[model samples]
Target: MDLSCSDQSDHPSRRRALAVATGLAAGALLPPAAATPSAAAPATGPAGAAAASYTNPVIWQDFADLDVIRVGDTYYASASTMHYSPGAPVLRSYDLVNWEIAGHSVPVLDFGAKYDLNGARGYVRGIWASSLAYRPSNRTFYWLGQIDFARTYIYTATAVEGPWNRLTTLSTPYYDAGLLVDTDDTLYVAYGNTTIHVAQLSPDGRTQVRTQQVFTTPSSVGTLEGSRFYKINGQYYIFLTRPANGQYILKSSSGPFGPYTMRQVLLDLPGPIPGGGVPHQGGLVRTQNGAWYYLAFVDAYPGGRVPALAPVSWTSDGWPVVQLVNGAWGTSYPSPAVPPPPRQVTPMTGVDTFDGTTLSPRWEWNHNPDNTKWSAGNGLTLRTATVTDDLYGARNTLTHRIQGPTSTATVQLDHSAMRDGDRAGLALLRDSSAWIGLKRDGGVTRVVMVSGLTMDGNWNTTGTGTDLASAPVSGSRIWLRANADIRPGGPRPGRFSYSTDGITFTRLGPDFSLGNDWRFFMGYRFALFNHATRALGGAVRVTRFELSTP
Candidate 1:
């Protein structure tokens, strides 16, 4: 591989001007473009679009905690799903700017009965960081993810979009793991946070044969994790993220288990951005034209951490440097050298009609859903299960990511079949969540807006909201909507409203300021929830769920 370096000077005033022009705050690297909520519309095209240039946070939506790999010009990205069923979402991209959900590594995370909605739960616990690798020798795709802090499993498939096979589950849990297939076809896994380790896998890639400590970061580094191991040009490289110090790269010419040399490739340089956090925990890929670029994420909430693309230039001494403009990461750079295919970029946020035989790829259950209690036929039907009053603990709460800067989501619910003590509606899901929906109490149907806090430390709602808004309703059908204004450098807040006509919406609850709680470690998502407060036999059907951003 040929690596070249070029030096370009940047001016501070010009950098600030560029940030303002791109709708990003002076210190914030990439902020969501201010949008006006409207009806669901067609996706315009690829984000960061220009005739010759594109912007950072290439992916405007939330596909956080990502790892990307390239095989023959096509790039595949895998992201953390964390308790969401059909976990470990894999996406495919051509230009590294536009992406679409290709598939998921697992159909359902049934590591134990808890993931299956049993007595126990896996909230904030399912699949974390995963490594997606391809082995050319036998033409197989492999995915490794840690579960329950005790098990790490390897899944394999002959194709990227697959009917994957669970090859084996390793007894040792490797946190934030990275998988590498060396030039000799030997397999290695690098993992851990404070002290990183490299371990060789058995010939079958099932168990660990031998392990050794390769490198350790200082306490000053501050939460180093997400190790990505790669072998290029006979040299071994490991990429690690230190949110306080930026991203670090370790290189070893000796071997995979290395006495490596470490360098801070990208630093949290001084900048004027609003939400200032380092770019870290991503993968690197050499483009079709031999140009290298790093795919990483920045801590931008309440939209959650979003991906960013930056150019990489290698020095004559074989060290890679993450390029910056005027002491900060560039907001816009030239597009990659390869030409993207003739396809319209699909919007990750949109409407789901529930008319199809299966659920849309955009939807994911809070956990492994009880399939017997849910179906997509005339409309999306969710049967109430025995659970607490909180939406977090309730099973079959279908969810979708909240779009950035500004957006609105609306859902039409048919509660004709709802039983007494049944609650169903639209919600903004997080550690602290709020909803506006229909509730049946004392044989009376009413429209209510409620908020709850996860006080037990397990995401189970303790009790009903302190401020409850309720009004009697005469019908079995209702419309609920949530408007989220999550622009950076401002209060990230959301509001809930209800409508009987679906045209005019009445605000029901106070504006809820979204929280960036570290426990969930995810963006606030819009969810459709139906749960039983007393007994089971309650159900709701959703006819239309529309998401729009201006």
Candidate 2:
């Protein structure tokens, strides 16, 4: 809805941060300890909008598993897209509440052939809970994530909107890792599941030096991950999430490798939104002014996991706590500072004309694509990349993050090029999906609405959707629309509509209720796809996509 100074004497981490930027004293691996915890400045902010107070789930779309940082006055956040191509989405904001799609740290999820959807595998896999870091000495941004739980992939770029290059892949996986560039310009990765491990990396941060278990979960904490490492108040801290359990912090006064003590800071949230589930597993950031904040995710099902920002206050004991309002997570908080109106980039929701040489960074393929099969020159031309029974096996199915509460996706489609046995449409997707579009059979074309489609336990679409409704339609140009009420509870309604002249519309089919199944982690999406039920070479063009909210 809406949207700091440094104190070196206030917190040693501030001095260590400067050292991390300029390089610290070579010999000291750690900052000196104080009898009391180091201090940090209190927060100062306004919301992302003109309201002067920011709303929770700030960028209310599925920007999940975030790791955020501040570079100068701007904040950069990298998030997981799971099996989506361009795996890690990088979001930028002058004011944290009003974020923009900066670019992607990962150009493609090429960790394996399966990621290409070559074998109908890689669903609910690929990138997860990535760690994003910035090294001031080299002025580069780093993205690291465990892929398939087999290897950790690292990427580097000079800018947030990258021409990102894969630096290297470490054979050792760092699960839910937190990438930290320390005082001496040293790199360390704090990661793991229940048993946490801190790994030291090479000077450039590409290679692993060594890894050792730093902390083990207690019996009270069943499982723990999403480790975000920080040096604050001269203490090495690892902030962790026990998912539905609560948020916890591990403080090590000794050093990065520690004899550490743990504490559960908050639990059982009356989340930012009603029925928005729990907000968990995110990273923390310190504004240029030295104020601290935590950006976490709310499993707002049907809409997916959306980001929620909350302020952090340091306890006199040096611990950072998520400030609560009325004994619950507040719905609105003071936003970080920003320059006046008119942002340089487009906001998250808007109209996209498919006239660019490449698709906008906001669009991502369902998986690693067959790049040869698609182009964006004169509207999106998706030449059937896969000939399959269902959309799940279809490659190059383009998608955009669907918005929250309620939203509509409208697209102008040119379907004249569709050949026999071709299906081209607009869809609301997740484990269970639905769509409305054109299906060509023989020499006849029909406007069709399909629903009750679902994927198997292993993510394979057993078959195409049931035909809920169909009408004979003429002409090549048609407008397809989908409306969703993704407000985190029952009757998460998803519906389809169509128009012949882009004015008068007819609702189609029964409402396809968006499901809240936890097995399929990622939430509903707005999708554009064309696939062959028989053979390939058939294509369709999408002239424009307008994403709107009401």
Candidate 3:
């Protein structure tokens, strides 16, 4: 990691100018290219490519309470968790333009018996909107993730994926705290929920010396929670969630923590809905093109809210404001279109006979993961481990990541050659509380659904009780089709189905809306599942996985 903040001139040749002119342009951070007609096209490649920019939020899957920060050559972000383990899930990006879940903060926050987060049992015990900061001098990253008032701990690591050191454990009533370091290397820890407060940290980046300063009079600006402060030029801008009403910002000078004043509201609302308003938490990243942009989450009503990015411009008065029109807000800007999706298609190997030695990233898990639950041998063998009561326990679960709305992943599972209680199928999981998947029980292939905020099986079926072998031999190949379909009311509910053969799929269950707008849940996520209740290890063979847009 280079500590040298070289002069902008050294990197001038590679940096492009903003093609479109704007008042708050960061200057030379964006490319000088003009906005192309394809600017409206949806993004398909890694983050940062102009082709990935959208007039609206492109990756709309529910990733709630998001806090993003740039760390060295990568941008790291995390959000609230309903099922993801290790407390908070962390995402990394190279140019702040592209982002991927590198891992989690405190990778394996091995709580063991200290916390038991069963479906309904452990609702929100996990961490929420956590703030990220990078200490360049030591090349260490700091994260302050709070799991409500019960416990609030800070951790640090040299690399995102690391042997993180758990630091001070303070009983402060602060929840959702953000960490910031200034040009002078001074550290400030700030939190906002009911009130906004900042405390100075010891020079070593550990321990608080002075009492927290109540920076702002607690103002209910709607979804105002994820507070982040950034310095542009000389002015310090305080950004926080405005809840459902939209995000708002405050400005200050003199120092990082400040006697800041309200500048401008960053987001407005669409007419009125059943819910009063919908706001989201987001962070700002300055592109190399010299454009200052803000990325935040927006509640798309009952459809659930996900992360979105918009441009932030400054007014003539030096006040920062979110661009708006007719009192409504959106995610567009007069700028060069994002580039096209990358042409490289690094396809997964077609050989998935799972000799029990290999696992693809396409395979996922619910809640937390236990490496011992499965093994790759001569074939893919999944053995059930000790879990509390339901599937979320350390055992009996296999999962995968959600590719896209129009994508499909097909796998060949030969259950006929297996034993009972050994279920191998596909699923889309968010947390332990809810998930819908397909499992082969004995000779009957069934669609297993779990919802209602508990790990209870509210839905399940057994191929009409008839022998599945009697039907057309769809072969051992199973197709897991996941796609979004807009109903008559405009709600784009994501549907998951499976086929014995890749050609014809049987609609396994009713449509489950993709987003998690429902209170007390993180955004939506899709994953594959392979679990077993067998005494001896059983093998589920998958021949291949083909992912493609419809």
173 in model 2: Cα distance from truth in Å?
A: 0.8
Candidate 1 C-alpha error for residue 47, in Å: 11
Looking at model 1, which ten-residue stretch has the lowest summed lDDT? 19-28
Off by over 4 Å in 1: 1-50, 218-223, 270-273, 456-460
Backbone clash count for every predicted candidate, in the order shown:
7, 11, 45
Off by over 4 Å in 2: 1-50, 338-345
lDDT of each: 0.70, 0.76, 0.47
Error of 2 at 362 (Å): 1.1
TM-score of each: 0.88, 0.91, 0.72
Instruction: Tell me the tens digit of each residue's lDDT in model 3 across 1-550.
Output: 1010000000122121110000011211122222211222333344333453334443433455566655433456655553355555556554333455555665544444323323333433455556566766677867665553455567788777655678766656345566666656776665655356766678985567664555554444422445665555555656655444445566677665677776446444542122213333566555433344555555443333455556556555565455544654554434322334343322322234455464433333444555665566555545544422234443435443343333444554555544456444544443323343445455665545444323322212111111121122334545555554312135656555666656787665556654332343443444444555554455555555454455
lDDT of 3: 0.47
Pull out the clashing pairs in model 1. 26-272, 26-273, 27-272, 27-273, 27-274, 28-273, 28-274
Residue 422 in model 3: lDDT: 49
- State the lDDT at 384 in candidate 3: 44
lDDT of 2 by residue, 326-385 (tens): 987889875555454344557677898888888888888898989999988879999998
How do these models rank on lDDT, best leading? 2, 1, 3
